[model samples]
Target: MEHDRTRTRAWVLHPEIKSDEQRRVPEPALEEAVALAAALPDLDVVGSEVVRLQRAQAGLLFGSGKIEELGERFHENEVELVLIDGPVTPVQQRNLEKAWKVKILDRTGLILEIFSDRARTREGVLQVEMAALSYQRTRLVRAWTHLERQRGGLGFVGGPGETQIEADRRAIDEQLVRLRRQLQKVVKTRTLHRAARAKVPYPIVALVGYTNAGKSTLFNGLTGAKVMARDMLFATLDPTMRRVELPDGPEVILSDTVGFISNLPTELVAAFRATLEEVLGADLVVHLRDISHEETEAQAQDVETILTSLGVEDDRPRLEVWNKIDLLSSEDRQATLARAERDPAIFAISAVTGEGIAPLLSEIATILQGARHESTLSLTFAEGQKRAWLFRQEVVRSEEQTEDGFEITVLWTDKQAARFAAL
Candidate 1:
């Protein structure tokens, strides 16, 4: 991402609350938060830190002393925005902003901003706006001082539901209803398009993995398409599909989708369900992992958790792809390749270098070939295109040159036969 205008001077803080049972390691969590901040083009990350504490305060999030210390640092640096790497309540946000005199954004808020900026498709844009609206709806807590005043109800007895807050909630609900209707029309069109593709006989392979795990690189390498592949996180936000014919393998529609991260916001998880339906309907799920990262196992686990949450069955056909072997040291690279060789399901490769790709494609071909059937057909010499296509598909079992034209025995799928008949 590139930006020419002025940027927001931001600082990142990963709150390591020890009392939280599901807290991630603060060091990498902070690292990922900084990366997430960097993903947005208009945020100039000025500083970042791991703020460790025994527990979180209900109203202030951090104790007064530490808050004062952080306030002084932000003042000195002129930090315009503060991004908390964990969840922060509306009260906590209001207090922290007042104390530090800077805008406050939690992990969920930051992700929404990135998605808003990167969404390309119509459905993608609608989903991000809906997610952002949902997030803002929660943030409207006591953050709005005027909302505390009574609106139309009795002064003493009936007070809870009669406030400006209720009015704001109604507005958001109305907008959500409008967006949902528009999204329903878009989704219906997409479903029709998907149904048309279903009759084409090509399988769909979905690529899923942690953010910045080199999925787009592998996608470009396989399809020869100019997809945006960057080191930054969430570079590819919408689902990108391309037709790719593997070496001696079936032709497949490869889908590169939005990256998954640890502790994804619930709003986004629901919003992105429609975008990730490709993975649910896929014939094969290819999980790409960045093997060189120190926290590779933890990252892979996060992807698995998201997959399970999406209701992907445990027995679904899948292949674990360990990528970026070239980034590893010589000794580690050898060991990684050795492990991959032992596990037939895992492939170690560098998508950049095109190393270890042939074997992986061969495996995919082997798996898809299970549906193939053998057939004997006679083709006239005049039908040269048909003869050439059979050999190109690598489905030709045998051939004999006859006086009429040629006799060929083929092992192929129903789709292949349909294509041949059309040719």
Candidate 2:
């Protein structure tokens, strides 16, 4: 299989629409798109450019002269695939592909391809498949010549005159239904596992950031679990959790989740919500930023946008983890350290060399400490099981016996308090 693989020659283009209100700076966006194209193993990026546009043309997405010029570049470079850095309508995609005589993939399509290639766990694979099918269902336009063919059906079902497009759409819909059913079962099992974890006294701390922002590296450093840590985009597709013990704090469940990207497809965000439940349920979320990157602030904004869309409560405890400090120059590092010193909410650390890790851990312990509260409760003698459970959890800081019942004071987290109430 490895020997049979052939790399496709690809060209990436970022459209710079002057009238568009939400466009990022063209150069960095183009660089990011090129990196996205390179993330696929079987793609050799031949060239990339930022195409200036006053406004998008509905039919072709670019002016005729610009289209012809890009076509010439594609021909000169022998490009087999063209990746657009933004959304392209179905009609525009079809027309552009015909004009350039090469396959065309919009930003959403490119992301789906990368996800399909990188998905590892069963749930991740299923979610990617569903998202790809949802995206494909929308692109079932006149792009393919085969869509002009007519398919034969039963007499009761349109009498052998169904267009190929209808048949294909129906097939995709059927597949989506099957995939949804399978996903439901998988999600049900996952929910059960999460419930089990909720019974434990450990708090969950989830690591989230943009792709290639050193989240997996930090996770490995803190938990000593060998997850796939690399400088590649989407290197860690599935969520990985491990038990981590802090110096003066209780053990915690540390989770490393999929990285967020700018303009992530809505289908993907919806499909992977279940995979990101760890982040939503986390007692503390650590926003790990690659402080060395030029667009670190913009990347952090993208992460926050996605988190907001995922319904992460605004009041949830959060910490800003400025990772990759080792990549900074001495002067820049000093500035970062100064900034961190002034802001108790931020911690600058290098996951590779373990620099500032001890202090970061101490900070995490402090934050977790803030989540705990002490409460006094009165339970009757009949509630022996609940009493035993509380004692087993070692949360019984103080206890007293009264005439009506035994009064107990327990120092515990909100999760523990909820569990005790339920009992």
Candidate 3:
């Protein structure tokens, strides 16, 4: 027998956005939610509306009358699920569900569900599950009513009318420990691979941008690696790193990280730290922007905001690459070019047509070479390890093996030279 389908009613509760900033809040999220609701196989989205809640009552979220009206509507319309467009606190979520007598899901929950549905890799699944579990731990009370129920196995179990908060916390803590252990293994393996790459010391360039900004296309164009490239939000969740060569005699490792989005969940940011380490350690950061996007400047600012949070804003050399030039008219293209010329660090290019990549790479090569430090240093033959370390870390200019010692002349970063000097 087929299970009964639940009627899902969704409404957007956007935090007061002025008309000016409405463009920043893409309609794709709502559209995606509608599509997801339709494909759920269990729920039907019957209606939706945008409600503006007052800031003071933001805790309860909806006003008392609004809550009563919505609850009545739920009863009248036979709504079994309520989808909220903003974050809902644990207490508020529980209270809302009790009032409406329906399952409630916040914006984070919806996004998590989408990610769960789309995740294909084992690592991606694990990361998403970890984030979901973290979120669920806070709202366990919403899922169960018999908090007074006690089990035989444990002295710590809740008794008569007691909340399951403690037990839920304990359970979540245990899972967190396990997840950390598993993620640690992944981190260790990634570290080993990174260390191995250090022996060859190819310059690394990383691409960072807002979601669906054509990073994967540029990556495929540059490296000839086929990764999933789609014109959808969060199309590529897993970071893909590939080897690329610039014509100016430098081999590079180019990495494309998961795209950033406005108001990305904090849990997601924390869970994906390992994946973003590639950006943190890169020699050059190519900040890709979608020139065709209507909110292109704002999108660029959002990427910079996230990068700043990652502590990469000031230290790393960056190239602002405005992509999708093919979509622009000749006048707009010339305007973009003129803007790029005014900013020495920015370049405009069409990743689709492969135009302007050559100059961008050449500029990057120059920056990478400038990052190297040229210095004269002396080392004893017995310190073969240090000599090898220098070779492993940087391009060695010259080396001589003598009866007493090995003499080397090298170009390296000042940081690396300091490391050699300390030895």
- Mind giving the per-residue lDDT tens digits that candidate 1 earns over 199-312? 556777899999999999999999988998988898888899999898877788899989999899888998887778889867789999999989999999989998998899
What are the TM-scores, per candidate, against the unseen true structure? 0.83, 0.86, 0.75
lDDT tens string, model 2, 233-309? 88788899999999998788899999889877777788777668889878899999999999999999999998998
Question: What's the lDDT of the predicted structure labeled candidate 1?
Answer: 0.88
Model 3 weakest 10-residue run by lDDT = 15-24
The C-alpha stretches of model 1 lying farther than 4 A from their native spots are 1-5, 143-163, 371-423
Give candidate 1's error at residue 283 in angstroms: 1.2
Clashing pairs in 1: none
Model 3 lDDT at residue 294:
76
Instruction: Estimate the overall C-alpha local distance difference test score of candidate 2.
Output: 0.88
Cα displacement (angstroms), candidate 1, residue 154, comes to: 18
